[model samples]
Target: MTSGKIGNQASLQSIFDPIIAAPSDRPFVVAQLGQSLDGRIATASGDSRGINGAAALDHLHRLRSNVDAIVVGIGTIIADDPQLTVRRVDGPQPIRVIIDPKGRLPATARCLATGDSKCLVVTSKAEAVPKGAEGLVIKASAPRIEPGDIVEALFKRGLKKILVEGGGTTISHFINAGMIDRIHILVAPLILGSGIPGLSLIPVGSIDEAIWPKTSAHVLDGGDVLFDCDLRHQRRG
Candidate 1:
């Protein structure tokens, strides 16, 4: 039973799909989500109760199986407190990553717990590094490690691909910093009316845009939409 918990038809294909289906040379995938037309990621109390569906959830774990790591910002860690493990399918376990600017993860956090996969905590502040997390820490000297620096560090560690899944701020930081190689935006059927926009900041533009990544969007089952795009040089018109 995949995370989607669907019938055997969809389940069968998902179960047998190759774990390493992604191209070896491709950079990591950064997936971001906003909400449906209503503009909400959760209900009034801030719970992601209906943020994802069965099929989408299953596909999410399947996608997780293809990457080398999964990332999120500290805000997500505090909010959802996810385990960040791939459980629905069988595959090589990917590393869990957290971008904690201030090293805010609690020692009691599930991410620091054993049973789940180990986590890589990236931060620039010295005090943020946890006591038992020396090996897991990737310290950057910059006041704030830019996206390029983060990717370069990951690459040096032999990680050719990674996946970033989180709230709007983290997504925007990567996009604006121009480190995201590819983006997958899953749009649910409902909306939040007033919550965080999918992106914290949208790049201002025309031919003079600082960054441009070629992007394409697609509609999926159950009113969900997916946008997969490559981020690279864009020649001005």
Candidate 2:
């Protein structure tokens, strides 16, 4: 491998060491988001493509390869339609888990198609999995499923390392629920003056009340900055 590739691998290892060393009885959940310098994940019309550079994209695929499963909210499915595979690197593909509370996943969604990796749909008890999707269905309480419950269910199924690859809503749910152990926020150089914001959480009254996670910053090959925030102890009680 080239020196640059070696450097990237070393950086990834350092970033993932804590997650890989997490306790086995529960899931080690990490959430990731790629946004612009101004914190917009997409434009006003929901058009989010190429927000991060090639190096940051590789970093994401490396994350997918390490985790046992990857989870996303249905909004992501409808918008990005990502296959959620480990194509950029050589590692076992993680299971694709979708939080589809309303059963809105279309029949033709790429994630639902037959593939090397298995797909699991987590829905509300009131909803059913879309027809003809060859995967397991997990049901939780109505309106929405608790992030903790989702983590527990996945852990029971042997998915101990989980990555929440999302639209902002899904990551926020996990963070607000105190189920996330860490979060990786990759910030690109561009600025979107107006668009969909990257993350949304309960507001704090003052700057002192804001969460200041123990974070480490790394510059990716193409100038995107990756902030590895350690939230293991900063989670809400």
Candidate 3:
């Protein structure tokens, strides 16, 4: 069996040693994703069909089992219409959160009416608040529905840990905002040479470059890989 160390073999320190903050009032945020060998999370046209194997999907559900909440963007909700619940195992489903900046989430989405899970739609103060949804819709005032703002709102609601399963923009927004505490990236063995790149809008510049996304990775079953990185403060690149 191939065995690896978290720090020595994979630079887990470089990835997770920094501290954005210890467990605080705000929920800790983690960005979780799986990409192809070529680092693509979807197709060239933004399709994520069959990108992950059944084992990878099941592994993701396992990861989901440990969090207090799960977040995604409205675009992801519309495109995937995911139930965003814990299944395939006997574990409590985390709360479901959607960042709908323009208040665009449909009232008819399953998230709105699910009794098994609570749904929180993060929207801007200026945008019309979504109404008639069975789920608890908590509104927070912000100039814009930014990545940091979303976490603050969740924290206020007493969720201490959040998992982000994204559509790229949402993940990148948190990465850029320096709000992500850890990143759990799963890598599949296949390669999608030309697809929607897994990362979106990382800042470019000496100052922006100072924040680096360093990670230590391990290979999981079925040729899948896992990288856990701490983003709060790693040595500025």
Candidate 1 or 3, higher TM-score? 3
lDDT of 3 by residue, 110-200 (tens): 7666538777777654344455332333454654466766787678778777888997778988877877888877788888779788887
Clashes of each: 8, 0, 1
**Of 2 and 3, the candidate ranking higher by TM-score:** 2
Quantify all predictions' global Cα lDDT against the true fold: 0.64, 0.84, 0.70
Best by TM-score: 2
Candidate 1 residue pairs in clash (backbone atoms < 3 Å): 36-190, 38-191, 38-192, 38-193, 39-191, 39-192, 40-191, 40-192
Q: Which tens-of-lDDT digit does each residue in 73-182 have in candidate 1?
A: 88888988877777777666677778876778777677666435567888876577665453344566765666677777776776776777876678778887766766
Decreasing lDDT order of the candidates: 2, 3, 1
Off by over 4 Å in 3: 1-26, 113-115, 125-144, 205-214
Give each model a TM-score: 0.76, 0.91, 0.79
TM-score of 1: 0.76
Q: After superposition, how far is residue 160 of candidate 3 from its true place, in Å?
A: 1.1
Instruction: Name model 2 segments beyond 4 Å from true.
Output: 1-7, 125-127, 131-141, 235-237
Error of 3 at 193 (Å): 2.0
After superposing candidate 1, which stretches have Cα over 4 Å from the reference? 1-26, 38-40, 43-45, 114-116, 125-127, 131-143, 205-221, 233-237
